[model samples]
Target chain A: MNSQLAAYATSNLWLIIIGMGIITFLIRLSMIVLLGNVKISDTVMRGLRYVPPAVLSAIIFPEMLQPAPHGVLDISLGNARLVAGLVAIATALISKNMFITIGIGIVTMWIWPFIIG
Target chain B: MEHSQSSPRREFWAGVKSEIPIAIGVFPFGLIFGSLGVLGGTPPLIVFAMSSIVFAGSAQFIGVAMINAVAPIFSIWTTTFFVNVRHVLYSATMGPKSQHLSLGWRVLLSYLLTDEAFVVTAWHYDNDNPEDLTHKHWFWLGAGLTLWVQWQISTAVGVVFGTQLPESWGLDFTLALTFIGMVFVTLKGKPMWGATLSAGAVAVAANGLPNKLGLMLAALTGIVVGMLLEGQGAQDE
Candidate 1:
């Protein structure tokens, strides 16, 4: 990775940023702009309802279980992120407050290492 | 109820006000992304440009990390595409509501469409009567602009000063926590729960897949499961 980073070129980075910006914008614009007037099927509409929870959970699970990106999954208490994520989940469920959940989650993540050590 | 009475200016400000708290939650992420980008060897100029250009938080983080790791450009683009495709869903949901707007309005609002902005704006759309949606797009514009400004400012701060902050502060975890809050709040009814859990499990199991294919697969699985369950529930009633 270090060697690759060393070999990385500024030109390549520019290419990436431009390419990513275009693709992301198009994705965001796909339905709202391109298909603005098209009639969506009921089935697709039903499926869209779940998109938020499903996509979000898909994101949340990996961040919590793996903690380290592309690393092995760790469900143990040793994984501070996992434990803290659980705390955040519980706080969200009970308090139904975004501020409280994030506050407690970050605090837990910060303090977990000392607690276990 | 008073949809027609409210001017576009009023709705726009209302949108901005509603998003302030959520924007506060999102502020840390912009900072983390900026600092991480620079620390990962990306130039400060490019890192800052990314906030304005790419705009999506998760995709930008992943893209910067991949660039730092010297991942192939194709893989980086592919990963970013999938990670952000969820915006397509958001756009689809918001499309009908904004269909009446001019092309320029649609274009601008689509650019501003984001998870945080979408959630708040969608909630507003859903709660109000469908007949009363004339100035709601202004609200979306206000909300989106607020987040957009906050993101740029935070990213600037992080790029300029974030490296001085300790990495051990684990500030990146705030993004995860924010998502957790979002997921739980949107989670109502059996189908939503089933979809969320299923998506989460699949994503974990499929984590080893190349180029983050697992995320897309897991999301699709969850959506299908949720739709099936909803269909079944309807039949049972």
Candidate 2:
């Protein structure tokens, strides 16, 4: 691990952070600043409508399916994260409340290890 | 027309109030990121700087992990861009409503934009009363600033004390739970379902892809699928 850190020198880390900051800011700023005046096409508008669900789903799925970062895919009932995710989904569907969904999900995750054992 | 006009100050406070619950959820993740970064061999100062500089939760997390893995700078930037490109869609959605605002306001608001802030601000805009239009941006500012402060403070706490916290507590799971909540709330109609299901499936299948290219590809696939389903629905109508 120290070897890995050694390769990532201090100057390089700073450069990466600044580069990430600029890139992220520009992505956030893209349409708001550049396309404020342009009339968006119907197709593009329709695509935009799906962005939230798609992007978020993309982020959520791997986290649930994988036991750890870069861990093997685990879709079985033994997978605690998968179980907690399903609980969260059911809670969201039923209650339509964010706090409740997250609360119940976290509770399920904490207790799940004991349940299976 | 008979109701009293709401002041920007009032709207701003309302925005801040509305964001409190979401901010509460996000706070733990900030702590997790801070602790994780420092524990993973990154300098504490750089970890704190990431919170201020990137101001994006997922991208920052991925960035720290990449730094620990000693990923190339170009790949880090590329992954960060892909992780955050969704914000472009948020900006576009808000563009029509905010077009009338001045350039400075646009720039500042854009900088403040994040997934949580976008959710609150968009909800406020969606249900906005005609009279409230003038001060809505203030509401956006308030919501953004609230999360901003919460994130910074949480990161500081994590950097200073996170290593002592037990990993068994599983504080990191909150991040996944938060995203799940966000996903379900935004899901509506058949097209939205199509988008979500496809994205989830593709993301899992492509999880092995390097530099999180899988996420970008999955998102695009879901968007296209959603649009196609919507178009087909329109034709049937």
Candidate 3:
């Protein structure tokens, strides 16, 4: 590890994470602590409803599409994470069960290397 | 629906029971986060501490990954803040239910709030009869504490025994799978589908960006698109 980077990480790591923790806690407390029984506006309410799908999909896409070691995109069958992710999506949609989807996805990833190799 | 005179203990246990599925799914995620944090070069003690304090799954993952990349500290904090912006919405959604509680209770619940806890608690609040909601806060406590305990145990296991575990296990991929499942579960209406697809497309297109800014960009774009579509539909109705 580069000494400069290591020192930077060691020095700033706690502050950043702790700041993040405080920020996260504040965000969670925002409406609960500040707002009192007022109804959320229609636009904001509807927008909030889409947060999970948007954020989760956003996170999942790059992780699945972008190769590790910061390599270029790999969308083909050779991308094991993408393949397992697809299977997991299918299982989730069909069964709407989290355990089954995750279980199958993990197993798929585990076996995909052998098959692709 | 008749309102039963339920005790706080009963409500608390109910919260725990309802949270079992979410807790189960979260276990592997915590383990992965702890292990990956170490593997990514963060000190094991910091990683273990993060499990309890930071507690948010995706943020910790991104934080450690950023640390590994040696990204600037400002970027790390900004990215983590973006990742957890959803909690603002959770807080809003939970606001009505929280109005009855005292400041201390509100603060505690807010600190405990996470994706899984929000979903479970929201479901309980939405479905239960209003009259029966007297002890519902206890239910929230139960669910939140259960997840907290589960997280600590799993993270400890991972930090202590993580290297001993084989790399072939492919445990890291489970985090992505978990998100995929969440996406599927949340995609109910056409607007939601539009948001998810657009977010995914944009995320892929912007994958090369530094500081994981692509994630925040995609999420914002998807929310705007979904909101517009929903507004259009409302006008036609």
Candidate 4:
């Protein structure tokens, strides 16, 4: 079992590393270059401010609540992440301090999994 | 010509000063990115260099993952191109405020632009006296420099021993957390809600799209939906 896991790790290491770097660069480069040249209206600009939070949260909440693969859809685990995330959110909104918000989030993530699992 | 002709470095520092406030939320993201890049097997030195040069967090993270996955250069380029398309909208919005500045300054700012800068700067504009982009500019410099330094330093630290870090840490989700933070800061009145809610709904529904372009498409869908709502209001009043 150990050897199998080790072998899987060794072979895929380099492939995973380079792929990550290239994709990351491409995403930001396009934004930097493109946003540099366009002409935006006030109404549109107001709208764009909201995009990151909405999309990211949409992606995150579902993933955090249930996770993936095994798909543990039970209310307890799901509720834990949901409640914890809200707590983190409130902390973030009130404090606007990264350490405090993330610290709370980490605690929630660690504890919730154990309590519910 | 006046400012650039005098001192390019001065302009650069000036830009950095004005751009600071928006950088606050972005800094931790860079720290997390650095932590993740090293943990994920990216070379330590290159991690810092990417932040200094590329200077874009989303791209750096995507690059870190794609390079390792060996998903082909073409896929990487396309995904990046589409993902960053929102900047086109962002650049357009900032144009009126930036037009008075030299082309060189415009180009420099464009390269430095990211989600945080766009959000903070976009909120504070007035059409009649547009050149007075004082606070907007400060917010960007504040935000950008803070994020830039954090990206390099944190990644370097991670590179030193990031590889040994465990998967359980899930540093990947820092991007998500950063997004949540920015969302809270940017969430305003109703028009904002329309774009966000519509975009999110589209993303969730279309999550099956290849290359995760569903999210990007959802944002595009959101822009249109937002425009329509505003248009409807114009007609109603």
lDDT values, one for every candidate? 0.86, 0.85, 0.79, 0.56
* Candidate 1 ranges beyond 4 A from true positions: A1-15, B1-6, B69-75
Q: Write the per-residue lDDT of candidate 2 for residues B67-141, one digit (tens) a residue.
A: 988888998998898778778778887777788899899889888999888877876776567435777899999
Local accuracy of candidate 4 as per-residue lDDT tens digits, B1-237: 242232335434544543453344344456666767666665566566666655656666776676555456566566665555555556655655665566565665665567655554454443213454434454445445555665566666666655565656555445445555555544655555677667766766676677667766777776677667767777888
RMSD of 4: 6.6
For model 1, how does the per-residue alpha-carbon lDDT over B1-237 read when each residue is reduced to its tens digit?
565578889889989988886788778889989999999888899999999988899899998898888898999899888778878778888887787899898888888988888877877787666568778898999999999999999999999997787877878778778889888855688888899999999999998887668988998999999998898899999
> Compared to the true structure, candidate 1 yields what TM-score?
0.90
Interface DockQ of candidate 2: 0.65
Q: Model 3 TM-score?
A: 0.82
Candidate 2 positional error at B180, Å: 1.5
Best by lDDT: 1
The candidate, 2 or 4, that scores higher on TM-score is 2
Error of 3 at A13 (Å): 6.7
Using TM-score as the measure, the top candidate is 1
DockQ of 3: 0.59
Q: What count of clashes does model 4 give?
A: 42
Query: Any runs in candidate 2 off by more than 4 Å, and if so which?
Result: A1-13, B1-7, B69-72, B127-133, B235-237
Q: Which ten residues in a row have the lowest lDDT in candidate 3 chain B?
A: B123-132
Supply the global lDDT for candidate 4.
0.56
> Which scores greater on lDDT, model 2 or model 3?
2
Task: Report clash pairs, candidate 1.
Answer: none
Runs of candidate 4 with Cα error greater than 4 angstroms are A1-76, A79-82, A90-103, B1-32, B35-42, B124-131, B134-138, B228-237
